[model samples]
Target: MSILLSVILPVFLVIGIGFLAAKRNAISPAGIDGIMRFSQGFAIPVLLFQAIANLDLREFDLRLVGTFYTGSFTCFLIGMLAAVYLFKREWEDAVAIGFIALFSNSLLLGLPITERAFGADATQANFAIIAVHSPFCYAVGITAMEIAKAHGHPPHTIPAKVLRAIFSNSLILGITAGLIVNLTGLPIPTVVDEGLSMLVRAALPSALFGLGGVIARYRIEGDLPTILFTLSLSLLLHPTLAWGLGTAMRLPDEAFRSVVVTAAMAPGANAYLFAAMYGRATRVAASCVLLGTALSILTAAAWLALLS
Candidate 1:
Protein backbone atom coordinates (compact mmCIF):
# COMPACT_ATOMS: atom_id res chain seq x y z
CA MET A 1 0.00 0.00 0.00
CA SER A 2 2.77 2.39 0.84
CA ILE A 3 4.49 1.43 -2.37
CA LEU A 4 1.31 2.05 -4.32
CA LEU A 5 0.84 5.48 -2.80
CA SER A 6 4.43 6.58 -3.03
CA VAL A 7 5.24 5.28 -6.47
CA ILE A 8 2.12 4.55 -8.49
CA LEU A 9 -0.08 7.30 -7.13
CA PRO A 10 2.25 10.12 -8.03
CA VAL A 11 2.57 8.77 -11.55
CA PHE A 12 -1.17 8.67 -12.18
CA LEU A 13 -1.75 12.00 -10.45
CA VAL A 14 0.61 13.80 -12.81
CA ILE A 15 -1.01 12.09 -15.73
CA GLY A 16 -4.44 13.07 -14.40
CA ILE A 17 -3.32 16.64 -13.98
CA GLY A 18 -2.06 16.70 -17.51
CA PHE A 19 -5.26 15.19 -18.76
CA LEU A 20 -7.26 17.87 -17.03
CA ALA A 21 -4.97 20.59 -18.27
CA ALA A 22 -5.23 19.43 -21.84
CA LYS A 23 -8.92 18.71 -21.70
CA ARG A 24 -9.57 22.18 -20.33
CA ASN A 25 -7.14 23.80 -22.75
CA ALA A 26 -4.93 24.98 -19.92
CA ILE A 27 -2.07 23.88 -22.13
CA SER A 28 -2.40 24.35 -25.85
CA PRO A 29 -1.70 21.51 -28.22
CA ALA A 30 1.33 23.32 -29.57
CA GLY A 31 2.60 23.74 -26.03
CA ILE A 32 2.13 20.05 -25.43
CA ASP A 33 4.00 19.32 -28.64
CA GLY A 34 6.90 21.48 -27.55
CA ILE A 35 7.07 19.73 -24.20
CA MET A 36 7.01 16.34 -25.83
CA ARG A 37 9.63 17.41 -28.33
CA PHE A 38 11.95 18.57 -25.57
CA SER A 39 11.42 15.39 -23.61
CA GLN A 40 12.31 13.17 -26.55
CA GLY A 41 15.03 15.30 -28.12
CA PHE A 42 16.88 16.36 -25.00
CA ALA A 43 15.68 15.27 -21.58
CA ILE A 44 15.13 11.58 -22.23
CA PRO A 45 18.29 11.17 -24.25
CA VAL A 46 20.33 12.79 -21.51
CA LEU A 47 18.71 10.55 -18.96
CA LEU A 48 19.35 7.45 -21.01
CA PHE A 49 22.94 8.48 -21.60
CA GLN A 50 23.45 9.09 -17.93
CA ALA A 51 21.98 5.71 -17.08
CA ILE A 52 24.02 3.85 -19.66
CA ALA A 53 27.22 5.80 -19.04
CA ASN A 54 27.20 4.90 -15.39
CA LEU A 55 25.86 1.38 -15.89
CA ASP A 56 27.76 -1.59 -14.45
CA LEU A 57 28.29 -3.56 -17.63
CA ARG A 58 28.77 -6.70 -15.59
CA GLU A 59 25.03 -6.71 -14.90
CA PHE A 60 24.11 -6.79 -18.56
CA ASP A 61 22.28 -10.05 -19.22
CA LEU A 62 21.73 -11.21 -22.78
CA ARG A 63 19.28 -13.90 -21.73
CA LEU A 64 16.97 -11.39 -20.08
CA VAL A 65 17.27 -9.20 -23.16
CA GLY A 66 16.41 -12.13 -25.39
CA THR A 67 13.47 -13.08 -23.23
CA PHE A 68 11.91 -9.62 -23.30
CA TYR A 69 12.50 -9.15 -27.01
CA THR A 70 11.10 -12.54 -27.88
CA GLY A 71 7.95 -11.89 -25.85
CA SER A 72 7.52 -8.44 -27.35
CA PHE A 73 8.04 -9.59 -30.92
CA THR A 74 5.79 -12.54 -30.34
CA CYS A 75 3.06 -10.17 -29.16
CA PHE A 76 3.63 -8.09 -32.30
CA LEU A 77 3.15 -11.14 -34.54
CA ILE A 78 0.10 -12.25 -32.63
CA GLY A 79 -1.46 -8.81 -32.85
CA MET A 80 -0.78 -8.61 -36.57
CA LEU A 81 -2.29 -11.99 -37.21
CA ALA A 82 -5.35 -11.23 -35.05
CA ALA A 83 -5.98 -7.96 -36.85
CA VAL A 84 -5.77 -9.64 -40.20
CA TYR A 85 -7.79 -12.74 -39.40
CA LEU A 86 -10.19 -11.90 -36.57
CA PHE A 87 -10.82 -8.30 -37.49
CA LYS A 88 -10.91 -8.89 -41.22
CA ARG A 89 -8.94 -5.72 -41.80
CA GLU A 90 -6.76 -4.79 -44.75
CA TRP A 91 -3.12 -5.65 -44.31
CA GLU A 92 -2.05 -2.01 -44.04
CA ASP A 93 -4.64 -1.18 -41.44
CA ALA A 94 -3.88 -4.40 -39.66
CA VAL A 95 -0.23 -3.43 -39.47
CA ALA A 96 -1.06 -0.24 -37.64
CA ILE A 97 -3.33 -2.11 -35.26
CA GLY A 98 -0.60 -4.59 -34.69
CA PHE A 99 1.76 -1.81 -33.70
CA ILE A 100 -0.79 -0.35 -31.32
CA ALA A 101 -1.29 -3.75 -29.79
CA LEU A 102 2.30 -4.30 -28.72
CA PHE A 103 4.19 -0.99 -28.63
CA SER A 104 4.32 0.09 -24.95
CA ASN A 105 4.99 3.61 -23.72
CA SER A 106 8.10 2.24 -22.10
CA LEU A 107 10.02 5.47 -21.95
CA LEU A 108 7.51 8.03 -20.79
CA LEU A 109 5.59 5.80 -18.41
CA GLY A 110 7.69 2.71 -17.85
CA LEU A 111 11.00 4.27 -16.84
CA PRO A 112 9.94 6.70 -14.16
CA ILE A 113 7.19 4.49 -12.85
CA THR A 114 9.46 1.47 -12.67
CA GLU A 115 12.18 3.49 -10.99
CA ARG A 116 9.76 4.58 -8.32
CA ALA A 117 8.00 1.28 -7.87
CA PHE A 118 11.00 -1.00 -7.87
CA GLY A 119 13.94 1.31 -7.01
CA ALA A 120 17.15 2.57 -8.63
CA ASP A 121 18.39 -0.91 -9.41
CA ALA A 122 15.28 -1.52 -11.49
CA THR A 123 16.19 1.35 -13.78
CA GLN A 124 19.32 -0.56 -14.78
CA ALA A 125 17.17 -3.36 -16.11
CA ASN A 126 14.90 -0.79 -17.75
CA PHE A 127 17.89 0.73 -19.53
CA ALA A 128 18.31 -2.59 -21.25
CA ILE A 129 14.67 -2.49 -22.43
CA ILE A 130 14.82 1.12 -23.62
CA ALA A 131 18.03 0.43 -25.52
CA VAL A 132 16.47 -2.21 -27.72
CA HIS A 133 12.83 -1.13 -27.75
CA SER A 134 12.60 1.50 -30.49
CA PRO A 135 14.77 -0.33 -32.96
CA PHE A 136 12.95 -3.61 -32.71
CA CYS A 137 9.41 -2.21 -32.58
CA TYR A 138 10.05 0.26 -35.39
CA ALA A 139 11.70 -2.40 -37.51
CA VAL A 140 8.80 -4.79 -37.20
CA GLY A 141 5.97 -2.23 -37.25
CA ILE A 142 7.38 0.04 -39.95
CA THR A 143 8.30 -2.89 -42.12
CA ALA A 144 4.76 -4.13 -41.91
CA MET A 145 3.44 -0.72 -42.90
CA GLU A 146 5.80 -0.51 -45.84
CA ILE A 147 5.22 -4.02 -47.06
CA ALA A 148 1.48 -3.64 -46.84
CA LYS A 149 1.55 -0.25 -48.52
CA ALA A 150 3.80 -1.57 -51.24
CA HIS A 151 1.43 -4.48 -51.85
CA GLY A 152 4.05 -7.17 -52.54
CA HIS A 153 6.60 -4.84 -54.17
CA PRO A 154 8.27 -3.93 -50.83
CA PRO A 155 9.71 -0.45 -51.01
CA HIS A 156 13.39 -0.25 -51.90
CA THR A 157 13.84 2.81 -49.71
CA ILE A 158 12.86 1.12 -46.43
CA PRO A 159 16.31 -0.04 -45.36
CA ALA A 160 17.83 3.37 -45.83
CA LYS A 161 14.90 5.07 -44.15
CA VAL A 162 15.09 2.76 -41.15
CA LEU A 163 18.83 3.18 -40.83
CA ARG A 164 18.52 6.92 -41.07
CA ALA A 165 15.75 7.01 -38.53
CA ILE A 166 17.62 4.79 -36.09
CA PHE A 167 20.93 6.61 -36.37
CA SER A 168 19.40 10.05 -36.24
CA ASN A 169 17.28 9.19 -33.22
CA SER A 170 18.30 11.19 -30.15
CA LEU A 171 17.67 8.36 -27.71
CA ILE A 172 19.75 5.97 -29.76
CA LEU A 173 22.48 8.58 -30.09
CA GLY A 174 22.61 8.96 -26.32
CA ILE A 175 22.72 5.22 -25.84
CA THR A 176 25.46 4.84 -28.44
CA ALA A 177 27.56 7.61 -26.97
CA GLY A 178 27.14 6.21 -23.47
CA LEU A 179 27.98 2.69 -24.59
CA ILE A 180 31.09 3.97 -26.35
CA VAL A 181 32.20 5.88 -23.29
CA ASN A 182 31.45 2.99 -20.96
CA LEU A 183 33.30 0.51 -23.18
CA THR A 184 36.33 2.79 -23.58
CA GLY A 185 36.37 3.63 -19.89
CA LEU A 186 36.34 7.34 -20.65
CA PRO A 187 35.51 9.54 -17.71
CA ILE A 188 32.56 11.88 -18.11
CA PRO A 189 33.49 15.40 -17.14
CA THR A 190 31.98 16.58 -13.89
CA VAL A 191 30.36 19.65 -15.44
CA VAL A 192 28.98 17.70 -18.38
CA ASP A 193 27.70 14.97 -16.13
CA GLU A 194 26.12 17.50 -13.83
CA GLY A 195 24.44 19.26 -16.72
CA LEU A 196 22.92 16.02 -17.98
CA SER A 197 21.94 15.03 -14.48
CA MET A 198 20.08 18.32 -14.17
CA LEU A 199 18.38 17.91 -17.51
CA VAL A 200 17.29 14.38 -16.67
CA ARG A 201 15.52 15.64 -13.55
CA ALA A 202 12.84 17.14 -15.79
CA ALA A 203 12.36 14.03 -17.92
CA LEU A 204 9.78 12.18 -15.84
CA PRO A 205 7.08 14.76 -15.17
CA SER A 206 7.39 16.43 -18.54
CA ALA A 207 7.05 13.07 -20.21
CA LEU A 208 3.96 12.15 -18.18
CA PHE A 209 2.33 15.48 -18.84
CA GLY A 210 3.12 15.24 -22.51
CA LEU A 211 1.65 11.78 -22.58
CA GLY A 212 -1.51 12.92 -20.82
CA GLY A 213 -1.83 15.79 -23.24
CA VAL A 214 -1.57 13.36 -26.12
CA ILE A 215 -4.25 11.20 -24.60
CA ALA A 216 -6.58 14.12 -24.03
CA ARG A 217 -6.15 15.32 -27.58
CA TYR A 218 -6.69 12.06 -29.37
CA ARG A 219 -10.28 11.06 -28.79
CA ILE A 220 -11.27 7.46 -29.20
CA GLU A 221 -12.46 7.06 -32.79
CA GLY A 222 -12.72 3.40 -33.75
CA ASP A 223 -15.04 0.46 -33.40
CA LEU A 224 -15.48 -0.02 -29.69
CA PRO A 225 -14.87 -3.76 -29.76
CA THR A 226 -11.72 -3.50 -31.81
CA ILE A 227 -10.36 -0.76 -29.60
CA LEU A 228 -11.04 -2.85 -26.51
CA PHE A 229 -9.29 -5.78 -28.14
CA THR A 230 -6.19 -3.74 -28.80
CA LEU A 231 -6.19 -2.55 -25.19
CA SER A 232 -6.43 -6.14 -23.97
CA LEU A 233 -3.44 -7.18 -26.01
CA SER A 234 -1.42 -4.25 -24.73
CA LEU A 235 -2.37 -4.16 -21.05
CA LEU A 236 -3.00 -7.83 -20.48
CA LEU A 237 -1.53 -10.14 -23.08
CA HIS A 238 1.84 -8.48 -23.56
CA PRO A 239 2.72 -8.39 -19.86
CA THR A 240 1.52 -11.94 -19.32
CA LEU A 241 3.79 -13.19 -22.06
CA ALA A 242 6.66 -11.18 -20.66
CA TRP A 243 6.14 -12.66 -17.19
CA GLY A 244 5.96 -16.21 -18.45
CA LEU A 245 9.04 -15.84 -20.61
CA GLY A 246 10.92 -14.08 -17.82
CA THR A 247 10.16 -16.89 -15.43
CA ALA A 248 11.21 -19.54 -17.94
CA MET A 249 14.44 -17.67 -18.62
CA ARG A 250 15.15 -17.47 -14.86
CA LEU A 251 15.58 -13.70 -14.79
CA PRO A 252 16.70 -12.41 -11.43
CA ASP A 253 13.77 -11.10 -9.42
CA GLU A 254 14.57 -7.46 -9.99
CA ALA A 255 15.07 -7.88 -13.72
CA PHE A 256 11.91 -9.95 -14.05
CA ARG A 257 9.90 -7.34 -12.14
CA SER A 258 11.32 -4.53 -14.28
CA VAL A 259 10.54 -6.39 -17.46
CA VAL A 260 6.97 -7.04 -16.38
CA VAL A 261 6.31 -3.41 -15.46
CA THR A 262 7.76 -2.26 -18.77
CA ALA A 263 5.69 -4.76 -20.66
CA ALA A 264 2.56 -3.48 -18.89
CA MET A 265 2.96 0.07 -20.08
CA ALA A 266 0.20 1.56 -22.20
CA PRO A 267 0.30 1.73 -25.98
CA GLY A 268 2.82 4.36 -27.07
CA ALA A 269 2.09 7.83 -28.44
CA ASN A 270 4.12 6.97 -31.55
CA ALA A 271 1.87 4.08 -32.36
CA TYR A 272 -0.95 6.54 -32.92
CA LEU A 273 1.38 8.82 -34.89
CA PHE A 274 2.53 5.99 -37.11
CA ALA A 275 -1.02 4.93 -37.75
CA ALA A 276 -1.82 8.49 -38.75
CA MET A 277 1.26 8.64 -40.98
CA TYR A 278 0.15 5.54 -42.83
CA GLY A 279 -3.38 6.98 -42.94
CA ARG A 280 -4.87 3.66 -42.10
CA ALA A 281 -6.76 2.70 -38.92
CA THR A 282 -5.93 5.91 -37.13
CA ARG A 283 -9.03 5.65 -34.96
CA VAL A 284 -8.02 2.31 -33.55
CA ALA A 285 -4.59 3.66 -32.78
CA ALA A 286 -5.92 6.72 -31.03
CA SER A 287 -8.46 4.74 -29.08
CA CYS A 288 -5.86 2.35 -27.81
CA VAL A 289 -3.60 5.16 -26.65
CA LEU A 290 -6.38 7.02 -24.92
CA LEU A 291 -8.14 4.16 -23.19
CA GLY A 292 -5.11 2.08 -22.50
CA THR A 293 -3.59 4.99 -20.63
CA ALA A 294 -6.71 5.59 -18.60
CA LEU A 295 -7.00 1.96 -17.63
CA SER A 296 -3.32 1.48 -16.91
CA ILE A 297 -3.65 3.44 -13.70
CA LEU A 298 -5.52 0.53 -12.20
CA THR A 299 -3.74 -2.20 -14.12
CA ALA A 300 -0.27 -0.92 -13.33
CA ALA A 301 -1.16 -0.60 -9.68
CA ALA A 302 -2.38 -4.17 -9.67
CA TRP A 303 0.82 -5.40 -11.23
CA LEU A 304 2.91 -3.46 -8.76
CA ALA A 305 0.97 -4.70 -5.73
CA LEU A 306 1.16 -8.28 -6.91
CA LEU A 307 4.82 -8.09 -7.85
CA SER A 308 5.78 -6.37 -4.61
Candidate 2:
Protein backbone atom coordinates (compact mmCIF):
# COMPACT_ATOMS: atom_id res chain seq x y z
CA MET A 1 0.00 0.00 0.00
CA SER A 2 2.82 2.37 0.78
CA ILE A 3 4.45 1.42 -2.49
CA LEU A 4 1.24 2.16 -4.35
CA LEU A 5 0.86 5.54 -2.70
CA SER A 6 4.46 6.55 -3.03
CA VAL A 7 4.95 5.50 -6.63
CA ILE A 8 1.88 4.53 -8.62
CA LEU A 9 -0.48 7.13 -7.22
CA PRO A 10 1.81 10.01 -8.06
CA VAL A 11 2.15 8.79 -11.65
CA PHE A 12 -1.61 8.66 -12.20
CA LEU A 13 -2.07 11.98 -10.49
CA VAL A 14 0.22 13.65 -12.97
CA ILE A 15 -1.60 11.91 -15.80
CA GLY A 16 -4.92 13.08 -14.45
CA ILE A 17 -3.66 16.59 -14.22
CA GLY A 18 -2.61 16.45 -17.86
CA PHE A 19 -5.98 15.11 -18.89
CA LEU A 20 -7.83 17.85 -17.08
CA ALA A 21 -5.55 20.50 -18.47
CA ALA A 22 -6.14 19.30 -21.97
CA LYS A 23 -9.88 19.04 -21.47
CA ARG A 24 -10.06 22.56 -20.11
CA ASN A 25 -7.88 23.88 -22.93
CA ALA A 26 -5.27 24.92 -20.45
CA ILE A 27 -2.67 23.48 -22.80
CA SER A 28 -2.66 23.30 -26.55
CA PRO A 29 -1.83 20.31 -28.70
CA ALA A 30 1.47 21.96 -29.45
CA GLY A 31 2.27 21.97 -25.76
CA ILE A 32 1.58 18.25 -25.53
CA ASP A 33 3.74 17.60 -28.59
CA GLY A 34 6.57 19.56 -27.06
CA ILE A 35 6.31 17.63 -23.84
CA MET A 36 6.48 14.32 -25.66
CA ARG A 37 9.38 15.40 -27.82
CA PHE A 38 11.38 16.62 -24.86
CA SER A 39 10.69 13.42 -22.95
CA GLN A 40 11.55 11.08 -25.82
CA GLY A 41 14.34 12.94 -27.60
CA PHE A 42 16.29 14.27 -24.66
CA ALA A 43 15.27 13.29 -21.17
CA ILE A 44 14.63 9.60 -21.73
CA PRO A 45 17.67 9.07 -23.92
CA VAL A 46 19.89 10.60 -21.26
CA LEU A 47 18.31 8.48 -18.57
CA LEU A 48 18.63 5.29 -20.57
CA PHE A 49 22.15 6.09 -21.67
CA GLN A 50 23.25 6.70 -18.11
CA ALA A 51 21.69 3.45 -16.95
CA ILE A 52 23.15 1.38 -19.75
CA ALA A 53 26.58 2.98 -19.46
CA ASN A 54 26.83 1.95 -15.83
CA LEU A 55 25.57 -1.62 -16.33
CA ASP A 56 27.87 -4.65 -16.39
CA LEU A 57 27.39 -5.70 -20.00
CA ARG A 58 28.96 -9.11 -19.46
CA GLU A 59 26.33 -10.04 -16.87
CA PHE A 60 23.38 -8.87 -19.02
CA ASP A 61 21.00 -11.71 -19.77
CA LEU A 62 20.19 -12.11 -23.43
CA ARG A 63 17.95 -15.05 -22.59
CA LEU A 64 15.51 -12.81 -20.78
CA VAL A 65 15.39 -10.49 -23.77
CA GLY A 66 14.82 -13.42 -26.09
CA THR A 67 11.98 -14.77 -23.98
CA PHE A 68 10.13 -11.45 -23.69
CA TYR A 69 10.55 -10.55 -27.36
CA THR A 70 9.52 -14.02 -28.50
CA GLY A 71 6.35 -13.80 -26.50
CA SER A 72 5.56 -10.40 -28.05
CA PHE A 73 6.21 -11.79 -31.52
CA THR A 74 3.90 -14.69 -30.85
CA CYS A 75 1.17 -12.33 -29.73
CA PHE A 76 1.65 -10.20 -32.83
CA LEU A 77 1.23 -13.16 -35.15
CA ILE A 78 -1.81 -14.41 -33.33
CA GLY A 79 -3.40 -10.95 -33.29
CA MET A 80 -2.73 -10.43 -36.99
CA LEU A 81 -4.27 -13.79 -37.86
CA ALA A 82 -7.31 -13.13 -35.74
CA ALA A 83 -7.82 -9.66 -37.20
CA VAL A 84 -7.64 -10.97 -40.76
CA TYR A 85 -9.80 -14.05 -40.38
CA LEU A 86 -12.13 -13.42 -37.47
CA PHE A 87 -12.56 -9.69 -37.68
CA LYS A 88 -12.63 -9.54 -41.48
CA ARG A 89 -10.05 -6.80 -41.60
CA GLU A 90 -7.88 -5.90 -44.56
CA TRP A 91 -4.28 -7.02 -44.37
CA GLU A 92 -2.93 -3.55 -43.69
CA ASP A 93 -5.45 -2.91 -40.94
CA ALA A 94 -4.74 -6.31 -39.49
CA VAL A 95 -1.07 -5.48 -39.40
CA ALA A 96 -1.82 -2.26 -37.51
CA ILE A 97 -3.88 -4.18 -34.98
CA GLY A 98 -1.07 -6.66 -34.55
CA PHE A 99 1.45 -3.89 -33.95
CA ILE A 100 -0.85 -2.24 -31.44
CA ALA A 101 -1.24 -5.51 -29.60
CA LEU A 102 2.48 -6.25 -29.47
CA PHE A 103 4.23 -2.91 -28.85
CA SER A 104 3.83 -2.09 -25.16
CA ASN A 105 4.53 1.46 -23.97
CA SER A 106 7.71 0.25 -22.35
CA LEU A 107 9.45 3.54 -22.24
CA LEU A 108 6.93 6.13 -21.20
CA LEU A 109 4.93 4.04 -18.73
CA GLY A 110 7.04 0.98 -18.09
CA LEU A 111 10.13 2.82 -16.89
CA PRO A 112 8.47 4.77 -14.08
CA ILE A 113 6.21 1.93 -12.99
CA THR A 114 8.91 -0.74 -12.89
CA GLU A 115 11.52 1.51 -11.33
CA ARG A 116 9.14 2.52 -8.60
CA ALA A 117 7.79 -0.96 -7.91
CA PHE A 118 11.01 -2.98 -8.20
CA GLY A 119 13.84 -0.42 -7.87
CA ALA A 120 17.12 -0.06 -9.77
CA ASP A 121 17.56 -3.64 -10.93
CA ALA A 122 14.14 -3.59 -12.53
CA THR A 123 14.91 -0.25 -14.15
CA GLN A 124 18.07 -1.80 -15.62
CA ALA A 125 16.02 -4.69 -16.94
CA ASN A 126 13.49 -2.26 -18.41
CA PHE A 127 16.25 -0.34 -20.19
CA ALA A 128 17.65 -3.55 -21.65
CA ILE A 129 14.25 -4.43 -23.03
CA ILE A 130 13.68 -0.94 -24.43
CA ALA A 131 17.02 -0.98 -26.25
CA VAL A 132 15.88 -3.48 -28.90
CA HIS A 133 12.12 -3.32 -28.60
CA SER A 134 11.29 -0.47 -30.97
CA PRO A 135 13.55 -1.71 -33.73
CA PHE A 136 12.17 -5.23 -33.60
CA CYS A 137 8.55 -4.13 -33.45
CA TYR A 138 9.02 -1.56 -36.19
CA ALA A 139 10.87 -3.99 -38.42
CA VAL A 140 8.05 -6.47 -38.26
CA GLY A 141 5.48 -3.74 -38.82
CA ILE A 142 7.32 -2.21 -41.77
CA THR A 143 7.56 -5.55 -43.51
CA ALA A 144 3.89 -6.33 -43.04
CA MET A 145 2.77 -2.89 -44.15
CA GLU A 146 5.01 -3.03 -47.22
CA ILE A 147 3.78 -6.45 -48.27
CA ALA A 148 0.17 -5.50 -47.76
CA LYS A 149 0.41 -2.19 -49.60
CA ALA A 150 2.67 -3.34 -52.40
CA HIS A 151 0.93 -6.64 -53.04
CA GLY A 152 3.97 -8.77 -52.11
CA HIS A 153 6.53 -6.60 -53.90
CA PRO A 154 8.22 -4.63 -51.17
CA PRO A 155 11.22 -2.48 -51.99
CA HIS A 156 14.40 -4.32 -52.87
CA THR A 157 16.36 -2.05 -50.51
CA ILE A 158 14.56 -3.27 -47.40
CA PRO A 159 17.66 -4.20 -45.42
CA ALA A 160 19.20 -0.79 -45.98
CA LYS A 161 15.94 0.87 -45.19
CA VAL A 162 15.51 -1.08 -41.98
CA LEU A 163 19.07 -0.36 -40.93
CA ARG A 164 18.61 3.32 -41.56
CA ALA A 165 15.33 3.39 -39.71
CA ILE A 166 16.75 1.64 -36.67
CA PHE A 167 19.88 3.75 -36.45
CA SER A 168 18.03 6.99 -37.10
CA ASN A 169 15.83 6.52 -34.06
CA SER A 170 16.95 8.61 -31.07
CA LEU A 171 16.20 5.81 -28.61
CA ILE A 172 18.40 3.41 -30.55
CA LEU A 173 21.16 5.97 -30.71
CA GLY A 174 21.06 6.28 -26.92
CA ILE A 175 21.22 2.53 -26.50
CA THR A 176 24.05 2.21 -29.00
CA ALA A 177 26.11 4.89 -27.31
CA GLY A 178 25.52 3.27 -23.95
CA LEU A 179 26.51 -0.11 -25.34
CA ILE A 180 29.71 1.38 -26.67
CA VAL A 181 30.46 2.96 -23.32
CA ASN A 182 29.72 -0.27 -21.46
CA LEU A 183 31.68 -2.56 -23.75
CA THR A 184 34.70 -0.23 -23.75
CA GLY A 185 34.44 0.57 -20.04
CA LEU A 186 34.79 4.24 -20.75
CA PRO A 187 34.48 6.63 -17.85
CA ILE A 188 31.81 9.29 -18.05
CA PRO A 189 33.16 12.71 -17.19
CA THR A 190 31.84 14.06 -13.91
CA VAL A 191 30.46 17.13 -15.66
CA VAL A 192 28.67 15.07 -18.28
CA ASP A 193 27.28 12.71 -15.63
CA GLU A 194 25.93 15.58 -13.61
CA GLY A 195 24.31 17.15 -16.66
CA LEU A 196 22.66 13.86 -17.65
CA SER A 197 21.33 13.39 -14.14
CA MET A 198 19.68 16.81 -14.24
CA LEU A 199 18.05 16.05 -17.58
CA VAL A 200 17.00 12.56 -16.52
CA ARG A 201 15.05 13.93 -13.59
CA ALA A 202 12.51 15.46 -15.99
CA ALA A 203 11.67 12.27 -17.87
CA LEU A 204 9.09 10.54 -15.70
CA PRO A 205 6.68 13.33 -14.87
CA SER A 206 6.80 14.76 -18.37
CA ALA A 207 6.22 11.34 -19.89
CA LEU A 208 3.21 10.64 -17.71
CA PHE A 209 1.70 14.02 -18.43
CA GLY A 210 2.36 13.60 -22.12
CA LEU A 211 0.74 10.19 -22.00
CA GLY A 212 -2.45 11.64 -20.59
CA GLY A 213 -2.39 14.45 -23.11
CA VAL A 214 -2.14 11.96 -25.94
CA ILE A 215 -4.97 9.87 -24.57
CA ALA A 216 -7.16 12.90 -24.06
CA ARG A 217 -6.74 13.87 -27.69
CA TYR A 218 -7.62 10.44 -29.02
CA ARG A 219 -11.17 10.09 -30.27
CA ILE A 220 -12.69 6.65 -30.41
CA GLU A 221 -14.40 6.16 -33.77
CA GLY A 222 -14.40 2.54 -34.82
CA ASP A 223 -16.39 -0.61 -34.78
CA LEU A 224 -17.03 -1.58 -31.18
CA PRO A 225 -16.24 -5.24 -31.62
CA THR A 226 -12.87 -4.67 -33.25
CA ILE A 227 -11.90 -2.05 -30.71
CA LEU A 228 -12.92 -4.26 -27.84
CA PHE A 229 -11.14 -7.28 -29.27
CA THR A 230 -7.86 -5.43 -29.75
CA LEU A 231 -8.17 -3.91 -26.28
CA SER A 232 -8.53 -7.37 -24.76
CA LEU A 233 -5.46 -8.57 -26.62
CA SER A 234 -3.43 -5.54 -25.67
CA LEU A 235 -4.32 -5.30 -21.99
CA LEU A 236 -4.87 -8.93 -21.06
CA LEU A 237 -3.36 -11.44 -23.46
CA HIS A 238 -0.07 -9.62 -23.96
CA PRO A 239 0.81 -9.62 -20.25
CA THR A 240 -0.42 -13.16 -19.80
CA LEU A 241 1.81 -14.34 -22.62
CA ALA A 242 4.81 -12.54 -21.15
CA TRP A 243 4.24 -14.05 -17.72
CA GLY A 244 3.77 -17.53 -19.16
CA LEU A 245 6.90 -17.36 -21.29
CA GLY A 246 9.03 -15.80 -18.57
CA THR A 247 8.04 -18.39 -15.99
CA ALA A 248 8.31 -21.24 -18.47
CA MET A 249 11.85 -20.20 -19.27
CA ARG A 250 12.70 -20.02 -15.55
CA LEU A 251 13.87 -16.43 -15.59
CA PRO A 252 15.10 -14.91 -12.35
CA ASP A 253 12.37 -13.39 -10.23
CA GLU A 254 13.49 -9.86 -10.98
CA ALA A 255 13.73 -10.47 -14.70
CA PHE A 256 10.37 -12.19 -14.78
CA ARG A 257 8.80 -9.32 -12.86
CA SER A 258 10.35 -6.88 -15.30
CA VAL A 259 8.87 -8.76 -18.22
CA VAL A 260 5.41 -8.89 -16.69
CA VAL A 261 5.28 -5.19 -15.84
CA THR A 262 6.49 -4.23 -19.31
CA ALA A 263 3.96 -6.50 -20.93
CA ALA A 264 1.27 -4.87 -18.84
CA MET A 265 2.08 -1.40 -20.18
CA ALA A 266 -0.53 0.44 -22.23
CA PRO A 267 -0.45 0.43 -26.02
CA GLY A 268 2.39 2.69 -27.14
CA ALA A 269 1.83 6.04 -28.86
CA ASN A 270 3.96 4.70 -31.70
CA ALA A 271 1.21 2.28 -32.54
CA TYR A 272 -1.28 5.09 -32.96
CA LEU A 273 1.26 7.04 -34.99
CA PHE A 274 1.85 4.09 -37.29
CA ALA A 275 -1.85 3.51 -37.75
CA ALA A 276 -2.47 7.16 -38.57
CA MET A 277 0.40 7.15 -41.06
CA TYR A 278 -0.82 3.98 -42.76
CA GLY A 279 -4.39 5.24 -42.71
CA ARG A 280 -5.62 1.81 -41.75
CA ALA A 281 -7.58 1.04 -38.60
CA THR A 282 -6.48 4.36 -37.23
CA ARG A 283 -9.45 4.59 -34.93
CA VAL A 284 -8.87 1.16 -33.48
CA ALA A 285 -5.24 1.90 -32.81
CA ALA A 286 -5.98 5.26 -31.23
CA SER A 287 -8.72 3.76 -29.13
CA CYS A 288 -6.36 1.08 -27.96
CA VAL A 289 -3.93 3.73 -26.79
CA LEU A 290 -6.56 5.83 -25.06
CA LEU A 291 -8.55 3.05 -23.45
CA GLY A 292 -5.52 0.97 -22.59
CA THR A 293 -3.85 3.83 -20.79
CA ALA A 294 -6.98 4.84 -18.92
CA LEU A 295 -7.79 1.31 -17.79
CA SER A 296 -4.20 0.39 -16.99
CA ILE A 297 -4.50 2.18 -13.64
CA LEU A 298 -6.43 -0.80 -12.31
CA THR A 299 -4.49 -3.48 -14.13
CA ALA A 300 -1.12 -2.05 -13.18
CA ALA A 301 -2.17 -1.82 -9.57
CA ALA A 302 -3.23 -5.45 -9.60
CA TRP A 303 0.05 -6.54 -11.15
CA LEU A 304 2.03 -4.48 -8.65
CA ALA A 305 0.21 -6.05 -5.76
CA LEU A 306 0.81 -9.51 -7.14
CA LEU A 307 4.48 -8.81 -7.66
CA SER A 308 4.79 -7.39 -4.15
Give Cα-based local distance difference scores for all models: 0.84, 0.83
Please provide, for model 2 over 142-242, each residue's C-alpha lDDT reduced to its tens digit, 9 standing for 90 to 100. 77777778755557866676677667878778878888998888988999899899989998789889878878988878577887777777777878878
- The Cα error of candidate 1 at residue 291, in Å, is 0.4
Q: Which ten residues in a row are the worst by lDDT in model 1?
A: 145-154
Off by over 4 Å in 2: 1-6, 152-155
Model 1, which residues run further than 4 Å from truth?
A: 1-3, 152-156
Cα RMSD, model 1 = 1.6
